[model samples]
Target: MIDALHIPDFPMQRTCPFDPPQEYAKLRVEHPVSQVRAPTGQIAWLVTRYEDIRMLLNDPRVSADRRHPNMPLTEEVTPQTRRNIAEVGRSLIGLDRPEHGPRRKMLMAEFTVRRMAAMRPHIQHTADELIDAMLAGPREVDLLTALALPTPTRTLCELLGLSYDARDIIQRSANAQLRRSVSAEERQQTSAELRAYVDQVVREKTAAPTDEDLLGRLVLSNRETGLYDHELMVGLTMLLLVAGHETTASMIALGVTGLLQQPEKIPGIVADPAAAAAAVEELLRYFTVVDALPRVAVGDIEVGGVTIRADEGILLSFASANWDDEAFPDAATLDLARPARKHLAFGYGIHQCIGQNLAREELHIVFRTLFSRIPTLRLGADLDDLPFKKDSNIYGIDALPVTW
Candidate 1:
């Protein structure tokens, strides 16, 4: 019997430094749903198996709402941390249907396959501009600073009708807000700053409207439906700015890093633009950026034969689920040619990422252009030397040093 309490020490379940504890693999095979201590020191069930995670994610009894009062926090989280979490929880990702239904519907048309396809040329142009700047400079460059980060940040700025030049300040505030070690006061201040910045942008867009950008459309839709209030709109905008830019940037950097690490793959990525799409899918599966989406049990639920009590929290391990042996054979390896790449890198169920298509388009354009232009691109430093952000919900390299 694998004791849940015996799981190795982990910094924070969501942080990059915190790999799935050693005992997780054994628990997946032995006891897929087992009790574990959360970062806040609260005991919660961890669901590790793929099938079980899928079931739990879609289960109505498993609520994404954190305002349920009885929701559990990780052992390491403070009251202030809980408040921050709750603020973010107000977004669609944390709501169940009929609430999630309408908000997602309002934005669904914007992110459909057709809309994303239309955005490809612009995404490609953005990638090219960034790449041109990178090549214009010295041979040595930080790919994250020059290309990976700015491309998506600019893309989202265009989509949301915000200024691209605000990327640096926005990214800095986002980083500070996401850090677990930051003092409660610091985090609160950062959140307020970010909200104020976004609120100003929203006000500007409302005053001088152009074609329907994300915020404009959202503001219009909310007025019609009377669904989301001002705070919700602000939260949603903040969510887009943070969730949209950071994760996509990480994927671009990490995907390129993955290719450079396997020199053999570079030729294929360069030779065929079509190959980049498949490669992006494989990278998402392999990198598994957003590890898990936490849910609280609204009512009693059973997952993988374990009964979860109402109000208990669960971390649905999307990363582990993607690598589940049954669903993805040879899960440890990255196979760009692998067909049927239906991974939950975007997540699953009602809360499945709303911006997935946008993310895919951005990655496709980025990698396609990068590999084709800089065929000789190589890592300038060892993987270990790369800075990984210390404490964050999203895991990614801090900087990607590259040379061509």
Candidate 2:
């Protein structure tokens, strides 16, 4: 039996900088599904193996309901929990089945393959404009500001029919919510402000409703089918606004860092779109940035020879699963040709990212355009001097100093 004190802390920081927590590598081989103490002072099971992570995430019996008393949180129990539920309610990611299915179905229609295909031209244009600005600005620049951050923020605003000028408002609110370093009081206040802002936008869209954008369509849906309400729209909008850009922004920065590390592989990817797309998948797997997918067991379930009793919390390590040697041989090495579609980077099951198509398109456009334009682009600072986000739930560098 693993000693309670010896059980590695959940969400351990990466020791080797670019790699996932070293504890994950050891746990996957020695005890794939081991119990651990959370930062919140609760005991929880940490699932590290790829098969176990897939099984639990796909299992209907497992609950994503964050309201559950037994749910394990990486953060300490705080007043913000109750305030969040009261003010904004659960976003799409936090809801369980029955409530989850219809809401997801309604939104899925908006993110279909055809919709992403239609957005390709705009995504391409956005990438080109950003690159033009970056190239003209300076020999030394922080890439996160010039390209990685704005590309998705602007795209999401356009897709939702919101003002690109509101990027400051949206980004500030989003950063407050995502960063673990922020105080609960501050997070709650910012979250309230964000919801109010979205609610106002929803009201405006409802007043002068258009069918062209996601928010406008949802407003139209509420009127036609009577299936949604203002609160639901606000929740959905808040989710899309934050998630739509923040995660992709993190990926862009991290992806570029990963590619710069293996500069020899850059040529093949830059020359061929097909090769670049393949490399994008590999990059997604390599930097599995999301730290953990939290869930609580509603009923007894057997996984990896361990009985997860009712009410026991489970944290699925996406980073660990992506790095599993069994799933991807020599998993540590960056192989641009690896078929990484099966990786858990976008997650799995019904709750898998609805924006995967859009995200994939954006990544393809950004990587191809950025590298092809600035063939001499290289890191401006020493690797050790760069500030990586070890504390944030999303893994990425604070800024990428680049010189071309």
Candidate 3:
């Protein structure tokens, strides 16, 4: 029975037991850490417990670099496709200290609370613009298309100094890369195009400097410290564009959907914007957007009484940890009033998400404005009929159709 349960024919292992194939709870209690096969046919250690996952995230021995030979393959791809994937792995998300340290520090100042707070008014204005457009549209609207997706897209474009007209291409490239479905040739072409665009932007900024946006700041760093080259700058800009837009947009849509599902919470969110801040934390904890953060063990370690060998790849299931009964009592239920809602939705340790403040501000504006503007907003279709992007790394509803 254990073997059968462990070897279920699934794309990814049963990371979240709550969503489907309801046997995950049993597995978590029985085997907090266990070997599971990924879709790529490689085996990896699945860490489910909240405490153990947290410890592993902070462990120096756990490396985020997927280029390491020990890292398990999560998807199947050709040799050329693998090269593109490796290039992405070179980013901070895939690096440990020393290398990750300098890059993170370089960008940290731009994402501080003060910067985010200062940007709040602009974000709110962007949200209002999008919402206004949505209201002007047909009564039955796809909220994800009308407001959720575009809000972050516009924000990121403004923040990174990218032309808003380039949003469609950027979105397509990012979606293709994350989905890992594009042909190797197609992936390479898309990447080159994005890099070229970024390079041109960098050159323009260098020629005649304008206001200091994030990109301009990085360009200045390159000139001053000689630390960032064209490649690094392109990588940084791409990272900001893709990561910044997708995650926050999905969160806003998902968080609002959660609130709509629970009608009783709508009044509270509308009554006080500050209270909605706590609600954002709960929503993040409840619906962890990033399913897992993968790491390769650099040395032998024991977590939750289960031994992990050096060089073994591990998937830290944040969704599972958030729902772990030990960490969150009545973990399955969503409680906005839950104290200390410090969840790993943005990850933990050095790799904790830098744009968390931005994400929070966007979500807060989304929920607060959404409930306030369209008090009667509700799902236009049945719950089960909603289309969700199940295969994507960031889980979200594909189209959130709604009516006022």
Identify the leading candidate in terms of lDDT: 2
Q: Please provide, for model 1 over 341-396, each residue's C-alpha lDDT reduced to its tens digit, 9 standing for 90 to 100.
A: 68889988888888998998888888878878888888899877778765666667
Q: Which residue runs does candidate 2 get wrong by more than 4 Å?
A: 5-7, 81-91
TM-score of each candidate?
Answer: 0.92, 0.96, 0.92
* Highest-scoring model, TM-score: 2
Better by TM-score, candidate 2 or 1: 2
Structural RMSD, model 1: 2.6
Model 1: lDDT equals 0.76
lDDT of 3 by residue, 1-404 (tens): 24745554223533432252244466578887877776566678877788888899878999988677667655555566565555555756677877888878878978999988988888889888888988888889999988888888888888877789988878777665555345546756776677677778877877765555878877776677676776666666777777787788778777877787689878887788767888899889887878766789999998867789898889888888888878889888888767635788899899899999999988888788887888999999887777766666676777899998
lDDT of 2: 0.84
For all candidates, the clash counts are 11, 0, 0
Q: lDDT of each structure?
A: 0.76, 0.84, 0.76
Candidates by TM-score, descending order: 2, 3, 1
Better of 1 and 3 by lDDT: 3
Q: Candidate 2's residue-wise lDDT over 16-85, tens digit each?
A: 7689998888889888889987777778999999989998887888998877766777764356644464
